[model samples]
Target: MPQPQPNLTRRGLFGNGLWAAVVAGITGLSAYLFGRTKQAKTVWQIDPDKCVACGNCATYCVLELSAVKCVQVYAMCGYCDLCTGYLDPDPKKLDTGAENELCPTGAIERVFVEDPYFEYNIKEELCIACGKCVKGCEAFGNGSLFLQVRHDRCLRCNECSIAAACPSQAFRRVPADDPYLLKGAKESKPAGESKGIA
Candidate 1:
């Protein structure tokens, strides 16, 4: 007959039981976390005030068409016929001509609102996010035109390539609920009010 097996002490049993429980808890937590899809709480956006219109948004996005687009703040617009943003510097005439237009893609449309006042409109579908018009507006006009990421076309990538390439650090993550960080009214936006493009 075999000798009686040495019995496990109460302390040994408790310790072993505790260790198993700890291991099981950790494994369960890991599996639960691994199986869940982590929803992003934020999205990439451009800070119009901080942006220098460095032209990175036009080329660095990981999409065939860049999500960045020129948006107009109509309240801030001067509505001059000779819009610096719409026309090349000292163009032969103010009429809509390819050579005279500042936009390479001809995305900006000069609408006849009245005499000596034309409403500049952006052809969003044709825009290439080049920032050429934006730079011109800021430099020579009323600084009403600026760049913003259009969520309608944006992929909302985990890491935005345009943001990384931005020289001005203008790209940043904004709350998903409020994806846009658009410019306020021409005078002010009441100090923290989020605005939208017209």
Candidate 2:
């Protein structure tokens, strides 16, 4: 009888190599497609125009400290010694009395930038997303104080929980390259007129 052909023949080597190459190629394509799809869906955004500043974002957020924060519009600020947003809604005087402050978290820091002009800054660490500052600014000042999503603290979920609970439906998905939807140049008209009014 003829000797059995060697199991490890030239045909076996060629077939095994071809199959390995094909498997690798398929895996590479699958990874590429998965990456592309993931990139397309990675969007996290907040619409300052529609935010009601109701303080829901502070508590409703999934993070321990709400990823949403109140930002300032320095130019629009009247720099009044008595900021309605910063001070108590019904204040006894324009003093730094906690009782007279509107911020539940006391996150807004008011500094005397100059005579008749004060610099208003947000202490993000202290901000609780109550929107008191935004409301105060919108009501009296130029509407400069607005709410934004802090990406570092933000989980960047596929569907943000805050967006779902948003009263005004101000949340949206934006391109990953430019995630933060800053107030545009033309759109910047002080805080009171910018957007996100009650």
Candidate 3:
């Protein structure tokens, strides 16, 4: 005897189609979410020229140690012997001594380059981003020293605490690939320079 053939019902086909559609929708949603997660995101950075050395960077950052650090623009630096950034306002002597140092952390190192000239470099590890040195530099020197967000140390928070509290509004979002807004870069002219002006 021959066996009976199974029935091919329209309801069964409809049910299979609905299940396929549900799985397809779920897969599409997952792909979209994964792509969004992989998308490149910008990070907050400080424009050195715009930064006012307000001392907020040290205090407002969410991290225990602020991500901001003082970077020297060598091209703008005068390399003076009596660097205001290196020494306190009224030092007992014009010497590279710990007592006379302006930086509370002694982050600025003065190397004897030559007579009447000293090479100053910031020790990033010791920096507190207090802007004390920056204030002194801008006040008395060529404003070679400026604060910048050290991306390597930065947490890249969705809403940066330092940016929210910045008085000068120096913070801006920059591409993650090229985050730094370096000083003395020749791509753009300085603040006062123009095509017709001297």
Q: Pick the candidate with the highest TM-score.
A: 1
Please give, for residues 55-133, the per-residue lDDT of candidate 3 as tens digits: 9999888889899999999889999888999999999898988899999999999998889899999999999999999
State model 1's lDDT. 0.84
The residue-by-residue lDDT of candidate 1 on 1-198, one tens digit each, is: 987567877888899999999999999999998787354466788888889988888899998889999999898899988888999987998799899999999999889988878898898999889999999999988988999999999998876888878888788776677677677742443332322221
Taken over the whole model, the C-alpha lDDT of each candidate is 0.84, 0.76, 0.85
lDDT of 2 by residue, 14-129 (tens): 99999999999999999988876633544556777777788889888888889988887666667888777788878987777788888887788878878776777899999878
TM-score for candidate 2, residues paired by index: 0.72
On lDDT, the leading prediction is: 3
* TM-score (all chains, Cα) for each model: 0.77, 0.72, 0.74
Give the clash total for candidate 1: 0
Backbone clash pairs for candidate 2 read 49-196, 88-100, 142-191, 142-192, 143-191, 143-192, 144-191
Model 1: residues with Cα > 4 Å off, grouped in runs: 1-40, 185-198
In candidate 1, what residue range of length 10 has the lowest lDDT sum? Answer: 189-198
Clashes of each: 0, 7, 0
Global local distance difference test of model 2: 0.76
